[model samples]
Target: MDLQKQLNEDMKQAMKNREKQRLVVIRSVKSALQNEQINKGSDLTEEEVLTVLNREMKQRKESLHEFENANRDDLVAKVEAEMDVLHTYLPEQLSDEELQKIVDETIAETGASSKAEMGKVMGAIMPKVKGKADGGQVNRLVLQSLS
Candidate 1:
């Protein structure tokens, strides 16, 4: 994974600065990447590495939400910190407008006219927006369009 080099550099910088939380996150990312490499039996492409980072970020966000609801300020803070570090590696998220346009275009392309055709629309849209947009966001917008 080419991004592995960048992660190594960032980890070195974090270690030099004595940033414990940041270093932990970076190390976890490295560990995840290594595991993925072993599973695939080859180095991952940048996109595949991104899929791992994105999954980590999503998990952090969900934990943050649960912590907030449970009044666990301390855990919420930790999750948010981890999320901030992970965000640096993730691709810039698409704007709502941009995502909506893609959904509209996909709807047009797939000829999905009603809610029942949601699967077909999603099948066509996910590949177009993969890694560029969140699946949840695309699902919501597609639901709106079909409804």
Candidate 2:
């Protein structure tokens, strides 16, 4: 099933199971997807849906970090739970070694020689890694390898 339909089905199940936390996170995801559709004036592709999911997951991670820093363990737990739900819908992430291999390949493919070519390497690599790896992590690895 497409993400939208799957989310709807899951939302129904959450309501049936009286899973308040799951329901809340699912509703938030649904709202974000709907808002994107309205803003773009078209339906979202699977890739677009994945992008939205990634953005939501990233936001939750940032919020979790801030909550932890503030010693708000309760809030951190809630956000972490939401993050777990979000991760279920994303593609499997690449391991550090795998990411490094891909970065090396991309750098070679783009003939990138130094940090100055970071953008070129990133542009070449992101499409290959998108939805499978974190962009920030990929960028950092690329810079490290190049430098």
Clashes of each: 0, 0
Model 2 scores what on Cα lDDT? 0.93
Give the C-alpha miss distance for residue 47 in model 1, angstroms: 1.2
The TM-score that candidate 1 achieves is 0.95
Question: Residue 49's C-alpha lDDT in candidate 2?
Answer: 96
Candidate lDDT scores, in order, read 0.91, 0.93
All candidates: CA RMSD in angstroms?
Answer: 1.3, 0.8
lDDT of 1 at 109: 92
lDDT of 2 by residue, 1-147 (tens): 898898999999999999999999999999999999999999999999999999999999899989999999999999989998888778899999999999999898999999998999999999999899999999899989998
Model 1 lDDT per residue over 5-97, tens place: 889999999999999999999999999889999999998988899889888888888999999999999999999999999888887889999
Candidate 1 off by > 4 Å: none
Indicate the residue-level lDDT of 13 in model 2.
97
Clashes by residue pair, model 2 = none
The model with the greatest TM-score is: 2
